[model samples]
Target: MRHSVRPRAAALAILLVPAVGIAATPLRIVAEDYPPFLRDTGKGLTGPYADAFRLLMRRQGVEVNYQTLPMKRVFQQVAMQPGTCALAVNYAPGEAETLIYVGKVAPITLTVYVRQTQSEPITNIEQLRSRPVGAINIAEIRDLLGTAGIAFTPVDRPALGIPMLNAGRFDAFISDTRPDVQFIGGRGRPVKAFTLARAERWVACHAAMAPATLAMLRRALREGVFAAETLPVWHSYGMDSFFLETRQQWLQPAN
Candidate 1:
């Protein structure tokens, strides 16, 4: 016959067993067709920034699911929904308080492109004062141009801006490095020249997300796994690195 087990021994055994009920929350990430950095491969999503985000989240013990949408909708949905974040957005005026910035994953150069045949180089904002420029209908761009005293003809989409630039509808078109490169690279038409005038790209989170979640995202980006090889894809379009230099530059101080 087997001896009865001691009550304390049974209690200790129960206490030693690990809890199996907890589940990790899946991070829902929103991105657009900003290629080389974010693109749809048909098989799924693949790009330098997307890949880096995936790697970082995994290291932080977070599960991630990515969904692609139009750039404009991406921002809107993130702002309206909880448990959502958008990548590759610059610091804009009104957006500062509406979203929490995780970190700047790359330096985005907002540049002007004209036909290679054009001889004059745009070296200063003053040069654009009298000329009409093209830009996407984003508030930050409009704000930037307004602050610089540069006037622009805004287009609703980046693809439209490129063709209009080629057609000479505007004196020049303003675009950031990644989307611009992807637009030009995919186009059959030739681009005569381009030059970077400013640099600004950052990862922004929805206001609906908790402050703690934002902090976790920031920490993960700083200490998470990074692949140097993957960074070149973004560098191809003029991004310097996969992580921004400091949060201060990309984020506002807490009130």
Candidate 2:
């Protein structure tokens, strides 16, 4: 069942809402806790990815209350709950199809980070194999890293891994590049970066969601409804944001 939106707020919002397609009932969203993209502020959700989802869903007349959970818990909800969804899921390499993917919603650029004074810079997966690295245990990376025979420790959060990397507990940390770099800069830690893999993300729904909901989501994706809404979010964080002139003409969700 779709989660209910707050009565008074939804009532007031309905008075002001512009006309849209058939009003889908309100939904609650749970996305992975990826910072500067999707973050759990304890009070509520924030960041570019979260904000983008909110804007597009509202345009479709679907109210959303956003939250964050561990990657494991998010997928577990998708497997068990009919209306539940987990946003910001990366399309990982060699990952088995699990949930019903709703749309091509976002992108996250993954990269490797090292401490400032480290003399040896790692430029590729082969170089990282011999050294211990820190990263979240997201499935997208497992197959790629496992194939490369790389070693990594699963950190609870991306920022937590930074201090460990700086103190030499691990040789480096892998995560969405812009946010981790910002976190390190905020802490006065100088860090070096190496290009890794980039992944397209989705607002994935539980397989039990009505097929109509999934079709509606696909229409939104193909139309690029949130492209303009999310561009300024990237710029606010001082990142270069652009929509390349591809044949598809979709906005680059993230760099």
Q: What is the C-alpha RMSD of each candidate to the true structure, in Å?
A: 14.4, 7.0
Q: Model-by-model lDDT, in order?
A: 0.61, 0.63
lDDT per residue (tens digit) for residues 111-132 in model 1: 6676555567766667778887
Best by TM-score: 2
Candidate 1 deviant stretches above 4 angstroms? 1-23, 40-44, 136-139, 155-167, 178-197, 207-212, 223-255
Instruction: Give candidate 2's error at residue 22 in angstroms.
Output: 7.7
Clashing residue pairs in candidate 1 are 115-192, 116-192
Best by lDDT: 2
lDDT of 1: 0.61
- Give lDDT tens digits, candidate 2, residues 1-255: 112213233233333445466365777688777764566768777665665566567666677777677777887777777788778776543222657877777555567887777798777778887888887567666756787778789876666777788788888788654443344455436365676876667777876788877776676565332465444444444332322222123354333
The per-prediction tally of clashing pairs is: 2, 0
